[model samples]
Target: MFRLAHISDPHLGPLPEATAWQLANKRIFGYVNWRRNRKGVLTTDILDNLITDMQEHAPDHLAVTGDLVNLALPAEIANARRWLTSLGAPEDVSVIPGNHDAYVPNARMKAEEAWRPFMSGDIVHSGSLNFPYLRVRGKIAIIGVNSARATLPLMATGYFRKAQARALSKLLDDCKEEGLFRVVLIHHPPLKHSTHWHKRLIGASRFRKTLRKHGAELVLHGHTHLLTKAATEGPHGPIPVICVPSASQGLGSRSKPPARYNLFEIGGKDGNWQCRLIERGYSTEDKVISELGNQMLSVPNA
Candidate 1:
């Protein structure tokens, strides 16, 4: 069995001091918001403990959906690189970007430079880093797509362009032919109405259409900071789309759940793949991490 661990939206804390010029644009909003609302909630200690517990499980691979930094400051981006190294080697962990990682124009470029190793594909077609990259791990095909982009102030939107859609379609078909379990990773929830209009993923309809045309075994994302289970249409049937709570969120939040992560045990063969989902994280009643839920997502046909 291949054990894959999923985590997202760490929003790594202790926001570094930023210059006036750095905070002059959309990052100003994120800076203020982090100080007033998120500073106390998303703590490093919480994330550290959670990571410790997750490492104990020793998953075959780790998928970080996005939002590794808070303000996308240069220092924050660098710190995130160190944190990713601590998590594991680039070969063992795959990452995609989130809206917060691209809080300002060209900030995503900085993040990409720092995080290229963790998000890079096995083979580069154009000799440059591009989204919708494919990485094969055992029988699994991990496809990383970039949905996060810098938006106007007060907006936290993501975009899924037609270019990526076309690339993703081809990747899905190729992986299917190879009899690999395709796991598509994006930062934003792709289903319609999954998030607020100001934060929704543009071109979601086209994205869904591509998925319906060329199905994947599973889709993982993290932007809502809520534990969500939803499905979209696929050629074979319904495809499972899952979102885990922020990896840095603390308890006592009125709206959002505490930090959590998921473990998926993928087994079986081409015609009868079996998957088991195990949810683990903190709760309102305790600080210790424990198993919250375990159930079969896909079962072998009789």
Candidate 2:
């Protein structure tokens, strides 16, 4: 079996000191929000404990679904790279950016530069990093999709471009032909009405249409900071779209759940693939990381 661990929205913090110039634009709002609210709930200690426990389980690969830093400042981007290294080697981890990673116009480029290693695919696109990149591991084919982009203040929406949709459709078809279990990683939930209007994934309908037309084994996402389960139409059946709470959210969070991560044990072959989803994280009663639940994801011939 190929074991894959999924985590998201760590929002690594302590708010690296930002100069006045750094906070001149969209980051200023994020800075204020982090200071007033996010600072208390999203703690590094919680994230550290969760990662320690996740590493103990020893997944074959780690899939982080973005929002690694709070403000996407230069220092935060660099610090996130260090954190990624601590989790595992770049080859063992696959990451895609989130809305926060592109909080400002130029921050996305900076994040892409710092996180290139973890976000790159085995096949290069003309020596440039592109979305819908393919990374095959054992029987699993991991596809990284970038739905993140800079938006106006108070807007945390993501966009799924037509170009990415076209590329992803082809990748899904190709991977399906190879009989590989395809797992798509995106930062936003693709289902319509999955999130608030201001924070929705633009072009989610197109994204779902692509999946329905081409099909995939699984879809993993983040950005809600809530443990959620939803699905979209697939060729064989409903594609499992799963999301976990923020990796750094501490207990007693007023608005969101505490830190959590998912482990998916995927096995079997083309006509009879089997996948089991294991949810693990902290509970309100204690800080310990433990298994919360386990169940089989709907596969072609489960």
Per-model C-alpha lDDT, please?
0.92, 0.92
Error of 2 at 153 (Å): 0.6
Clashing residue pairs, backbone N/CA/C < 3 A, model 2: none
Q: Which residue ranges in model 1 land beyond 4 Å of their true spot? A: 125-128, 299-302
Off by over 4 Å in 2: none
RMSD score of candidate 1 (Å): 1.5
lDDT of 2: 0.92
Model 1's TM-score against the true structure: 0.97
Give the total clashing residue pairs for model 1.
0
| Model 1 worst lDDT run, 10 consecutive residues | 293-302
Q: How well is each residue in 81-169 modelled by candidate 2, as lDDT tens digits? A: 99999999999999999999999997888898888999989976555579988999998999999999999999999999899999999
